[model samples]
Target: MSAIIDFTTAGQNFQAYRAEPTGVVRGAVLVIHEIWGLTGHIKDVADRFAAAGYLAVAPDLMGLAGLDATLLAELGADRNDPVKGAAAQPRIREATAPLRSPESAARIRDGVKEVFNHLEATAEGAGRTAVVGYCFGGTYSFALAVDEPRLAGAVPFYGHANFTAKELAGINCPILAFYGEDDTALTDGLPALIVSMQAAGVDFKYTVFSGAGHAFFNDGNTQTYRAEPARIAWTETLEFLEKHVQ
Candidate 1:
């Protein structure tokens, strides 16, 4: 079974959609959503992880303290409507207005830290935690590895590489990153990232699937969805998590 739960961080309450493994647990995976906040597809991803024998939690990373609730709904309604999507982008920006501060960034990181804490408190496989995300969330998963030593592995789909050599040295876990050959915003940065990770002696492996574009894993958006790559990515992600999440 799956449900929404409240978690407090830095005196602010954030929501997460959590799902438990139908069988016993193999481990826990923190699933981060794209810039769209905690959408249905993100929840479905969490469910998929649960179905795969992991305790999955997808947090509402963009659900800031002062967001206008009505705007959130409108932005979500634009998910499939081209015209509405263009019109709703500003609302999406508005929804993230409060999170643009340094203090808010700390709060967001603290919120993620709490997920690891929750797993520890419950005696779940906190020590073997992995992080997976798409798009904006994927970017964060990369950032987390730069400073977080608790991560066992990270699977970031088309996320930008955002670490320096010094920052990469802080990573003690392996990373399995996925990218589309056509995602310039992400792949363009890979050469420098590869150098930094290699210099830091981090175990980093990545694959760029041909003929795929950004957000290829998101089946909800037909325009960018590529089933073949998504399938391969998923299989490799599971294998990587299994190999590392001991």
Candidate 2:
């Protein structure tokens, strides 16, 4: 079953696309969307997790970043078309620029916490929830692991590890992160991040796919999608979640 559900946190009401497992639920997953917001691609990913026997929820976390539902919807629609998506990049960047602000990051972090709290309280109970995210969502996946010790696991794809050793020390779960070797913006910092994670005693493992670029897991974009890498990453992500969350 699937539906749009409403949940509130810190006096803020948020809407999420939720998909329930068809059979017995083994675990639960929070699917964080790319910068495109809660587009159809995100919903489809949630459905895929549901078909895999995990309850999945993709929260629309754009409100705190200055993106309204109407604008996000239009942007999502534009992103579905190659030509339109290419042309809309500037607009998309402008609209989401506020997310880079420290204030917005703090607010979004709370939103993510609330979403996870809702999942634990109403869906999978406790100790059986993991997070999987792409791009922007991937960045938050790492942050959430640090902020929410109750998180079972985190799978971040191509997002920079922005936390320092002190912040990373707060993480209690294992992480399975993926990246494309060509994404220098992230891979260039991998060595330092590894050192920090090791010093923090965090169980962090990562894969950098050769020949793949940033957003390689986003098959919706022909320019960046890498089939073989994405396929392998998906398989590994499921395995990681099974071991940690299930």
Candidate 3:
């Protein structure tokens, strides 16, 4: 089952695409979108999680930045088209500019928490909700793992976050991160992050795929998709969620 539902958080109303499992649900998943917002690709990912016996919710966080579903969808289309995508860069940047402030990050986190609160209300979702995110969403995955002690686990794909050891120590759940060796902007910082995570005694595991770059799992963007790595990451992600979220 799938639907678009309205939710309120931080005094703002937002919509989320929800997918429910037909069989017994083993866990719940919060699917976070890339910078493109809650596009069809994200909806498809949520549906995939639902088919795998997990209730999945993908929130439109971009709405807080003044980007609606219609505009996000159009921007997403432009992002996937090489010719138009290049021309649409400025507009995309302008649209996302408002979300760069610390206040915006806090509001976004509140929205995520509200979604998690709803999931927690479910019988099978109480202590079994995991967060899976890509790109921009990945960064929030880390943030949530640190801020929300109720989270079961976190999966971040090619997302980077700078955290002091003190902040990292607040994470109570395990983290499973995926990265591409060629995604230097993020991968280059992995060693330092690893050190901080270890110093903080957090359970952090990661995988780096050779020949893959940023957004490797986003098959919607043909330019950066890596079939083999994405396949492996999907399998590993499912296994990790099954182990941690149950």
TM-score per candidate, chains pooled? 0.90, 0.93, 0.96
Candidate 3 Cα misplacement greater than 4 A, ranges: none
Q: Clashing residue pairs, candidate 1?
A: none
Pairs in clash, predicted candidate 3: none
Looking at candidate 2, what is the lDDT of residue 155? 97
Tens digits of per-residue lDDT for model 3, 1-246: 899999998679998999999978989999999988887789999999999899999999987766565766688788778789897888877777877888888889899889988998997689999999999999999988988999999999988778777889999999999999999999999999999999999999999999999999998889899999999999999999889998
Tens digit of lDDT per residue, candidate 2, span 78-118?
A: 87677798887788778778998998888888888888987
Q: How would you encode candidate 1's per-residue C-alpha lDDT over 143-192 as one tens digit per residue?
A: 77775788888888888776667888898889999999998877888888
What value of lDDT does candidate 2 attain over all alpha carbons? 0.88
Positional deviation of residue 108's Cα in model 2 after best superposition, in angstroms: 0.9
TM-score ranking from best candidate downward: 3, 2, 1
Rank ordering of all candidates by lDDT, starting from the highest = 3, 2, 1
Which stretches of model 2 miss by more than 4 angstroms?
72-87
Q: Number of backbone collisions per candidate, in order? A: 0, 0, 0
TM-score of 1: 0.90
